[model samples]
Target: MHVPDGFINAPVSVAAGAVAATAVAVSLRGARRELDERTAPLAGLVAAFIFAVQMLNFPVAAGTSGHLLGGALAAILVGPYTGVLCVSVVLLMQGILFADGGLTALGVNITNMAVVTVVVAYAVFRGLLRLLPAGRRSVTVAAFAGALLSVPGAAVMFTLFYALGGTTDVPIGKVFTAMTGVHVLIGVGEAVITAATVGAVIAVRPDLVHGARGLAVPLKLRVDGRLVDAPAAPAAPVPAAARSTRPLWISGLVTALVLAGFVSYYASSSPDGLEKVAADQGIDAKAREHAAADSPLADYSVKDVSDARLSGGLAGIIGVGGTVVVGTGVFWAVRRRRADDLTAAATAAPSAH
Candidate 1:
């Protein structure tokens, strides 16, 4: 959920900002182990894809809608650390460029939507994988379950944050009940989107999917009437063309463009789960205007564009483009630093010897 300004007080908001900052710092370090040549670029595309899919809000209830939170999907496709960064990037872009989330409440939004969602979803996903059958289908199933729970997890976190710093004096129980109830319905949409996306990626390039890695069960051999683990097969040399991620990357980028640029026009126009809950519970009584409200691309529309379709389409395209560029730059930089560290260690080892 994109927590707007005035919903949380200055003290709690600042505290949440510190928490978000620490989480991002930790993720940057953890991502060094997660991002590599094959996965780094895909991580960027994942962020863009999440940004695009989030635009296509689906109806959850009569007047409430929901969209992909991307935590479970990203974590399953990439890794949890990188997934947090991906959602954070999308939130930042939306807040600054689209005026969708408030700048002042950026920390609160990041904590709830990025850190909490990623942590909770990935934990559930990994736990389920341990108990479920080892296969591509299991990955998809776990993704669905993780994504389903992540939405309500975020709702609970937001409720706690509001309970501490809410500007209005609304009943805490009411807020929690309404937030969790609606988000559970919203979670179904999240689960479907996550499972489908994870399944599709696993089908095409299971190698690229972090959560799908090591899914092949080792073969067993019976020797002298005793069963024992068979010798591992030597990895096959991949063809250069087959090793190229270009095809998948290009196809994914195209799909994101289609969804954001055109398909988003058909998405439900109703308020999302958080917005509906806030309005109903008087949580927005003190909500302040977004600082970027005056931006040309504010509210997901181009300034002075009369055609709703064209303006929204352009804004969506711009958002996807900007997110990809920024996200790729960030990920590539992280990858390069990791490579540099390895090279430095190798060089120092020779001198030590």
Candidate 2:
């Protein structure tokens, strides 16, 4: 959830900021191992896709709506470290550009929506994979379960944060109950979207699915009087057509544009799980205005644009474009840094004269 300013006291907010910053720093190092030439670009696409899908909020209850938190989907597609970075990028773009989340509470949003969701979802997913059958289908199943739980897990984390640094004197127990209850319903939507997206990617390019890797069971062969493992066969050369990610990337970008630019117009006009709970529980009593509330693209609408559809559409397109550009730049820089590190290490090696 996008925690706005004033919900948490300044002290806890700053502490959460430190936590979020540390998580991002750690993820930068961890993502180096996860992102390669093939997956680095996909990581950027994943962030953009998450940003697009979040615009299409679906109705969860009569007056409550939910959108993709995207932790499980990103983790399943890329690795967890990269997954955290992906969601963080989307949150960053939304906060600074769209004013969807508060700048002062950026750390709270990142901690709950990025760190908590990614860690919980990926942990559940990996645990399920270890216990269940190793197959594409199992990956989808685990993804659903992982996503289903991550939403409530984030809710719980937010509740705890609020309990510690809540601006108002609301009942912590009541808030926790409401937050978890609504988010559990929201989690259903998260699970379906995550499973479908993961299934689609697994179908097209299983190699690109970080969670589905190493799923090919090894073969056993009968030898003379003893059983032995079969030697691994060399991989066949893939044609340029099959090897290229251009098609997938193009299709995904187009789909994101369509969703954000057009389909988002029909999304439910209701409060999301967090907003509903906050309003109901008086958590918004002290909520402060967003610092960028007067920004041209604030509130997901372009400034001075009379047409609702036009204003929203332009804002969505701009958000998607900004997220893609920033995400790609970050991922490419990380990838380049890795390559540079390797080159420097090789150069520093001792000469064996």
Candidate 3:
């Protein structure tokens, strides 16, 4: 859930900001191991996808709806560190352009939604992968379970934050119960989406899936009444320039556009889990106005675009546009920085006279 301003006091927000900053720093370093030329471009696509899917809010309880938190999906498809960056970029775009999340509470939102979800989900995913059978099925199962757990993980994190800095006087126990219970239902939806998406990718290009990297376990063959694993074959080299990125990139971008531009218009207008709880528990009374409320792109409507379809279409286009620009910029910079370090190491080698 996107936390708006004023839900947490300034002191707590500052502390949350510090925590978020440290988390981002750690993720950046972790990403150096996660990212590569092939996967770097997918980072932006992942963010755009997350942004689009999040618009399709499905109804959960009577008046509450929930959308994709996207941490597990991103981590399973790409990597955990990059997953954090993906969702963070989406949140940034929404905060500045959609008036969705609060500017002052940006740190809190990033920490709760991006950092906590990605870290916890990936941790659980790795743990499960170790205990499960090593195969594509195992990867998919782990991804599903990770997605299911990540949503409640975020809810618990938010509950902990509220306990520290909630503006309302609601009972902490009640808040925990409501947040965790509703989020678990939301987590089911998250699991289905993550599994389906990860499975689809694994089918097409298992090589590209980071979580499925070591899935090529040799099949066992029985010969002369003895069982033996087949000898491993060396991978055929793929030319760097021949990498088929355009098709997946174009298809993903097209899907993201359609979802945000058209499908989102029909999404339920009911308040999401966080909003519902805030209202029910009297925590929303302190909700503050978004700083970008006056932006032309705010509220997912384009200024001077009268047709609902056209206005929303433009907003969605801008969102995808902004997300890609920001995400790619961030990832490319990180990638290049990594490259620069490698070059520096090569150059600093001892010279043989």
- TM-score each candidate: 0.97, 0.96, 0.95
Off by over 4 Å in 2: 220-231, 351-353
Top candidate by TM-score:
1
**Candidates ranked by TM-score:** 1, 2, 3
Candidate 3 wrongly placed segments (more than 4 Å): 234-242, 351-353
Residue 218 accuracy (lDDT) in model 3 = 75
Residue 55 Cα positional deviation in candidate 2, in Å, after optimal superposition: 0.5
Per-model C-alpha lDDT, please?
0.93, 0.92, 0.88
Per-residue accuracy of model 1 over 1-353 as CA lDDT, tens digit each:
78889999999999999999999999999999999998999999999999999999999999989998898888888899999999999999999999988888999988998898899899999999999999998999999999999999999999999989999999999999999999999999999999999999888889999998899998989999998999998999989977889999999999999999999999999999999999998999999999988999998999999999999999999999999999999999999999999999999998996
TM-score of 1: 0.97
Model 2 clashes, total count:
0
Residues 1-353 of candidate 2: C-alpha lDDT, one tens digit per residue: 78888899999999999999999999999888888888888899999999999999999998999999998888889889899999999999999888888887889999899899999999999999999987999999999999999999999999999999999989999999999999999999999999999999989999889999999977889889777889999999999887788888889888998889999999999999999999998999999999988899999999999999999998889888888889988998888888898888888786633
Candidate 1 yields a Cα-based lDDT of: 0.93
